[model samples]
Target: MTLTLDGEKIDRNRFTGAKVENATFHNCDFSGADLTGSEFIGCTFYDRDSRLGCRFSRAQLKDASFKSCDLSMTDFRNVSALSIEIRECRAQGADFRGASFMNMITSRSWFCSAYITKSNLSYANFSKVVLEKCELWENRWNGAQILGANFSGSDLSGGEFASFDWRAADFTHCDLTNSELGELDVRNVDLQGVKLDSEQASQLMERLGILVIG
Candidate 1:
């Protein structure tokens, strides 16, 4: 029986190491709150404009709208936020290892140089995000909307980008070694300074109706 504090602004509260269950925070703000090492199992935090550095390390924010928040440099390692919408936030250098947030909507955010390895982000809409110099290895991006996103200088090795609508995406100077691009349509995507393998280039060409005949 968790308290339904929906659409409320909770500031400077100590939620550290507390297990909150079935709490839905719609259009709420957690400004200056310390949620470090807390277990928010089956809780939702939506519309949080965190400007005072709220911490969220090893927290379980599963199956919720964790949206509209600025979680810059927040410890997001080992968090289970399945189908979460982490939109319009600044999460630079955040570690998302072993985090499962599939079909997420992460648009208009700045995730520059974030360490995101072994994560599941299938069918996600990552539009207009600054992902420059990011270490995105071994992540799932199947059927994702990577439109208008920037992957410049990002090491996207061993990542999957199959069947993604990548029109208007920028992959400048990105490393794509052993990346799964089986059905990636790159017709309107930008490849000005991209660095991919020969087979990967051929796959992109094939998707653009260009047959490679020896």
Candidate 2:
């Protein structure tokens, strides 16, 4: 079934297996909506609204702005987006594998236990965000700002985090195997009680004060 939402206020609607392609939503509100198993390809969501359990697979969201919305458990795997603003949203348990986010502002968002594997998160701002137990494998986070964020128990293997500021961020128990940590500020961040390998610990000790004598 094909659904088109154009300049309408649709609240609390449960749509499953619905195809909404190339539609434009202007100032439409979708608060408290259950859009599970719905596909939105090449759609543009303009304005602020909350969406719960919005399942999307192979959807294209170019130039979509999800500002100030609660998108908890929104599955957006293999989606491509440009200039998306997901600011101040609760995105816990959201899946974003192979998703591309260009010039996105996801600041102050809650991404607790979210899965973001092989995603492009370049030029994104994550200030004061919480990403506990999130999976961020092989993601591109170049030139991102992650000040005062919580990344405990998160998997960051093979991720590119070049030139990012991690001041006052908590990375306790997070995996950093083969992840790029270049140009990151380790002085303001706390790495105490973090699970690190011998090579990772040696690299961190070079920046932080750790006396090692054999």
Q: Which one is best on lDDT?
A: 2
Q: Please provide, for model 2 over 181-201, each residue's C-alpha lDDT reduced to its tens digit, 9 standing for 90 to 100.
A: 776555666665555556665
Q: In candidate 1, what are the lDDT values of residues 9-124, reduced to their tens digit?
A: 56544565566666655545454344444445445443345322233434455433333333343444445544333433334334444443433347654334245555455654
Report clash pairs, candidate 1.
Answer: 173-193
Q: Cα miss at 144, model 2 (Å)?
A: 2.9
TM-score of 2: 0.51
| lDDT for each candidate structure | 0.55, 0.56
Error of 2 at 47 (Å): 12
Measured against the true structure, the TM-scores of the candidates, in listed sequence, are 0.49, 0.51
